[model samples]
Target: MFQQKSYQTQVSGTLYLVPTPIGNLDDMTLRSCKLLKECDLIASEDTRNTQKLLNHIDSQVPQMSLHEHNYRERVPQLIKLLKDGKTIAQVSDAGMPSISDPGHELVVACIQEQIPVVAVPGPTAGLTALIASGLTPQPHYFYGFLPRKKKKQVEELQKLADQVATLIFYESPYRVAATLEAMRMVFGGERQVVICRELTKIHEEYIRGSIDELCEYLQETVLKGECCLLVAGKLEEEPILAEYSLEDGLEMIATRVAAGTKATKAIKEVAKETGLSRQELYSAYHQEE
Candidate 1:
C-alpha cells in the first residue's frame, strides 16, 4: 500500500522570490504585499530589515533569517515544509534578491527538488537607474558593483570601454568618486555619463554630463544614498582607408606633424579623418618630403 500525493490547487509549498524597494516604500507592489501576507513562511535576508517592512503591511507571517551565511543550512528545512505543502516567501533586505545580495543558492536548490518557483516582481535599482538616465535603451550591460580593488575595477571597465551600449553600475557613496575616475580613464573625458543618486527618495537627484564634468561635480558636492552610474556607449569606429585622395592624405600628415602631433598617432588620426591607410599616408608623406 502507498500513500497518495495531495493535489491541492493553492500551490502547496511554493517558493516566492520577492523584490523589495531600493529606497522608497511606495515602490512596493500590491501583489508583493498579498503574496507576502499569504505565504506560510517568510525567509528574509535580514530579519531586522524585514521586520520594519512587515510592520508597515500589518502582517504577522512568521519570519526567519535566510541570508548568504545561512542559506545552505536553511534550504533543506524550507524544502521540507514545501514537501509538506507549505508556501514559502523569500525576500532580501532591499532591491531584488540574488542581485548582488543573496538567495540564488536557495532558488537553485528548490528547482533541484522539483519545487514550484514563483516571482513577485517589484522595484530594481539597476532598471530604475537605466530607465531614468535617458541613455540609449538597447544594448546595455549591468555590472552589479565593481570590485573594491583599483586594478580589478580598471580591468573590468576597460573591457567594456569599446562597447556600443549604455553601461550601468551600482556603487556606494565612498567609492563613487574613485569608480568615476577609473571610468574616465577607460572611457575618456568626453564620454556622456549620468549619476543617479538616492532614487525614489526625497534627496534623489540626477546629474548628467561628460565623464570630466561628472568627476568635477562629485568633487564639489557631497554624495549620499545608493547610486547607479550610467555611461553612454562608444561611437561606431569609422573604417580607415576609405576617404580622401593620396594628396589629401599627405596634406593632413604634414598639418598634424607641424602641430607637434606624434607621427604614429597623427598618421592614425589622419587615417581616421581621411579614410586613408596609415601605411599609405606614411609612404606618401615620405615621398613628398
Candidate 2:
C-alpha cells in the first residue's frame, strides 16, 4: 500500500483535483480560487468553460484541455510536467473533476507514477442536492449518470434494488422523466424520490414526492437544466424471533414475495435477518403457500 502524507515534504509536483461550482459562481470556495491563481498549470475538461471561471477569479493561469477525447495524449504530458515540479490544478466544466466528468484516467496515471493528488473539496451537485432532498444523509450511495439505453439502465438499477441506503444519480433534463419512470418500474411506484433541477442557479427547484407522483407531474412541465435524482432505498428490517413463533419467518418471507420478490430470494433474505435456517424457512414458506 502506498502512503500519502499529502501536506508533508515531497518532491514531485502535486495534482490538485479542484472542484468548480456546479452552477452559481458565488459557491466557488476561496481556497479553490487561491489555488487556481497559484498553480503552475490548469488541466481542464473544457478550456472554454474553465476560462469563464478563471476570468471571474481574475487569474489567467494558462490551461490545456485534458478531456475524454484527448486524455491519452494529455496524461503523459501532465505527468511529465508534474515530475519536473510543476504544480497542476485539474477542473471540469462543472462539479468535481473525474466525477461523471473527465479526469479519472489522468488521476490514475498520476497515482501510479507516485504523484500526489490532493482533492480540494467544493460544490458537487450530488451531495448538494442530497442534503436538501429530505432523505437519509448518512449511508448514502452516489451512482453518477446511469446508462443511456433503457434496457441497460433498468438492469443496472435492479442490481441496486436491494440496497437500503439513499441513492443519488445525475440525469440530463431531457431524459429525467424517462429515468424516473424506469425507477418506478424497478423500485415500485410508491418509493419516495426527490428530483432537484438547475441546482444552485436562480431557477433551482426541488420536487419531492413518490416515484409515481413526480412521474405524473413531469408530464405537464417541460423541465430544463441538469437534474439530480435522489431515490429513497428499500427500508432495512430485521425480525426478532424471540418475541414471535418460528412460523413468523414464513409470514415475513410471504410479505417479501407479495412485494414482487422471488420466493427463493425472499426466503433466503428473511431467514438471514430472522436467524432461521434457510432450508427450513424455504420449506415452511412454500408449504404455507
For lDDT, the strongest prediction is 2
For model 2, residues 1-289, the per-residue Cα lDDT tens digits are: 6788899877999999999999999998999999999999999998998999999999879999998899999999999999999999999999899899989998899889888999998999999999999999888999999999999999999999999999999999899999999998999999899999999999999999999999999999889999999999998775564754467888887778889999989877877777788988777776776
lDDT of 1 by residue, 1-289 (tens): 3232424354447888899888888788998998888999999999899989989888789997887788778988888898898888899988888888888988888778777777777888888888889998688888889999999999998899889989988899889999999998888899999889888888889999999998998898878888898999998876664557988877777788999988878878887787678898888777776
After best superposition, candidate 1 residue 288: deviation in angstroms? 8.9
CA displacement after TM-score superposition, residue 130 of candidate 1 (Å): 0.6
Residue 221's lDDT in candidate 1: 83
Return the top candidate by TM-score.
Answer: 2
TM-score of 2: 0.83
